[model samples]
Target: MSNAYTSPIPIKRTNLGHALASEWTKIKSVRSTVWTLSIFLILVIGIGLLAVANTQSDDYQDVPFTVPAFFGLMLGQICLITLGVLVTSSEYGTGMIRTTFTASPQRHRVLAAKALIFFAIAFVASAGSILLVGLMASGAHSGPEAGDIAWGGTVVKGGLYVSLLGVLALAVGSMLRHSAGAITTMLGVVLVPAILPGFLGIWESTQKLGEKMGDYNAINSLAAIFQIDGPDSSTGSSQLVLLIVITAAAVVGAFALLEKRDV
Candidate 1:
């Protein structure tokens, strides 16, 4: 008999699929994921129904049936943002990232996996909730007067927009490596531009700058996607393009930092 021995177990090279599976497991197994998503569902669905119930048939004349969903999403997105930060920052807090990095030596792959998985979850949840609300609203208020209710457009664009925001939060989390700090940074990113414009408007010299910022802030971007009137003439496509550019830049920065930084 030969002295060499081989084990019966088989091994395969790891790839993005393996990383994705691992991330999926981690995300699903966490309590924070469950809680945050639960709250998001409640806020989106509950508030949407309430808004619809309070409205008259005339309310749908100008706005799409899905407009009510926007109100709930405005608050629900905070939950997604919080969840996004926790996805990465939680691991760092508990020192679990070391093991994750060891299991997947390619840091970029791990981050990519996280981003893909998170985006899928966020998009599905957001779109589903919006669709449910839209259907309810349409059923309750659809009539000849409700002209051109673009609920379908709202569902697709609204979902994509919210999902990108979550991914951006993930990038911020990865770069910051702290939960509270990353969440705060994202909140500021969302709110500061919107609020700053109001303050800037008080001064004549900065009024134009304020108008420019207000036109492009997160609130206006979201409102435009929902087919609501905003301060500026920015179309949904323009706002989405701007968001995509910002998110891509943040993701690139996260990848670069992950490569250079020690675990």
Candidate 2:
């Protein structure tokens, strides 16, 4: 009698592409994604419609041009942040993070894949919200020419800005590892600076500091990507400098901690 031996097939490690696919599937399957996106649509589209309906100007002349669209942008950004938090924090919530790390040892790859997925989701939602608002606004007007849909660099950049903010939120969730903590911190990032602006205004000594700093607060900084006459529009170079510095610090810090910390 002869003995026969067989070798088992080699298992391949999950690559970034596979990781992205897996993460995308998990994201789409979650009930949370649907809820977040639904609420986002309601607030953005609902508010946008209201803004157009209640416009002080009955004619197209009454519209602020960008006000209807901007209103939706502002509200849609919140949903982006929520989705961002979920992308990473949910793994921690369900204790699946350990498995994720086991499957993909490179933390950078995990975060990178997550951010990419989140950006794609956010961009689609944000862009769609903008387009819907623009359409609603156009329908509300009955002039010789329909209100032009401003698909300018400003609008495109604005969409990108919202997507990046989602990426930022995901990084925060990864760093904090707790949903409550990540959300609270993000709200602080959105609101605290504005609260201090008034105090700075009152204090003559710090007036300039507050004026220059407060006018370009966090939200404004992000919102500038969309504004034709944003807070820093007068000096394009200055706006670019501020945007680069703020965004770089945030993304770099997230990457650093993600690389060094234990999952």
Candidate 3:
């Protein structure tokens, strides 16, 4: 009997869900993620404790919401940025992005998955940090705001603000596409606008521009978000708006880059 010709069937390609799972596994597997998160937890909680220890209460109203938030930021931003840089850039660093692109050719899906994962990570970190601050600040103090300490609206807003900062970093990382470049840009974006005025001799220019820049700077704007009083048209709204607009632009730019740039 003559044998019939036979052909092998091709393997099916995995869907987006599988790609997401694979990406998640990559993120969780990184040592930098673990270390950065550990340091973030310790710094946030430790700072809260330190702030409470150093605090002298005249009136509960004296306890500025900005205080503990700053305490957290002192440590949180550094480590959070580290994590953010690693999230997307590590793949580039390891040449894993090629495989990732192969698996999920829709670049937007990769970014969306990364954003979702990083957002969740930020939320958990913020919650822990806020809870630590609340616990530390729960004791005796002065001012009509004594009741406000435990239920302080600032803590809630502060947590969300920190989460957004993480998102901003991720967006930035995507735009820069290099870990060091991303980090440098993040620092410059936060610091340069505020610091330049202090050094420049252009007093008149600095005042107008400084005030405007101050309004738009990320650090300044985040300070607004974490402020007890909350932000309106005044104070740091300009800075906050600037940061938001920049973040939006960065995300859009990242998407465009991913769509066109060879991974």
Candidate 4:
């Protein structure tokens, strides 16, 4: 028989979809994803509901119900960041990355797949939870004085915030290849740059620069999207652009490192 007729196995080129499936399997099978996301939901939904229960209808008279949801999400960002780091870092920790690279042989493809899968999972979960809490908070505080409920921008923005944070963490993990080290770096990414400006603001010489940093910082940008931050309309756009820029840079760095570094 000819080769075509006699061959029992067909050779098919692997693509991103296959990689994504593999990554999805990896992420789902891991305990970190479960524990991190579970705590995220509890903190987000629990705090939001608890806040609503304590507040009177008079509270809604001046504030939008979306406020409480944003509050919960702000604190829950830690869970998202941790999960992101674990996605890639845990593999390195357990020496599974070598096997993964051996199976795929295409490093960039694996990274991209991981990013897409994690982003989808994180964004959907966060957005859905925020919407649920927002609706519930609105109902609990609804009255004639309760103004229009704008959940679209806030929900999407908040979702993107957490999702992008996870992506950043993943990128950092790939570069560092250590779970603890990457997690610490990311915590600084989320915490330090945001507050350093405040400390610098104490010096009159640096006050202007500090104010600029404060205005463009991620947390303030997130708050600005929820309309609870400040009068500056530029904070939202500035923060969004900053995140996209930083994430894009990290992604490039991750791919470059993957090529140069040994598994």
lDDT of each: 0.91, 0.71, 0.69, 0.85
Query: Which residue pairs in model 1 clash with each other?
Result: none
Model 1 lDDT per residue over 1-263, tens place: 67877878898999999999999999999999999999999999999999999998887777888889999988998999999999999999999999999989999999999999999999999999999999999999888866655569789888899889999999999999999999999999999998999899999999999987887787888888887763233348788889999999999999999999999
> lDDT tens digits, residues 1-263, model 2?
98796668877767899889978988899998999888877877788788888863343442324446666666677787888998999899999989988878888888888888878887787767766776666656646554342434444555666676677788788888899899888778667776787888898999998887766665565445444353334322344455546656776787898878776
Model 2 clash pairs are: none
Residues 170-260, candidate 3: write the lDDT tens digits.
Answer: 8888877889998887777567876875655367655777666665555665565555353332344444455557667877887888888
Off by over 4 Å in 1: 1-5, 230-234
Per-candidate clash tally:
0, 0, 7, 0
Clash count, candidate 4: 0
Estimate the TM-score for candidate 1: 0.95
TM-score, one value per model: 0.95, 0.82, 0.81, 0.93
- Order of candidates by lDDT, top first? 1, 4, 2, 3
For candidate 2, the per-residue lDDT at 48 reads 72
Candidate 2: where are CA atoms >4 Å away?
1-13, 56-66, 142-151, 218-245
lDDT per residue (tens digit) for residues 1-263 in model 4: 65556666988899999999999999999888999999999988899888888877766554456677777777788899999999989989999999999999999999999999999999998988888888898877787766664557778888888899999999999999999999999988878869889798889999988887887766777787777732333326568778988999998999999999888
Which candidate ranks first by lDDT, i.e. highest? Answer: 1
Better of 2 and 3 by TM-score: 2
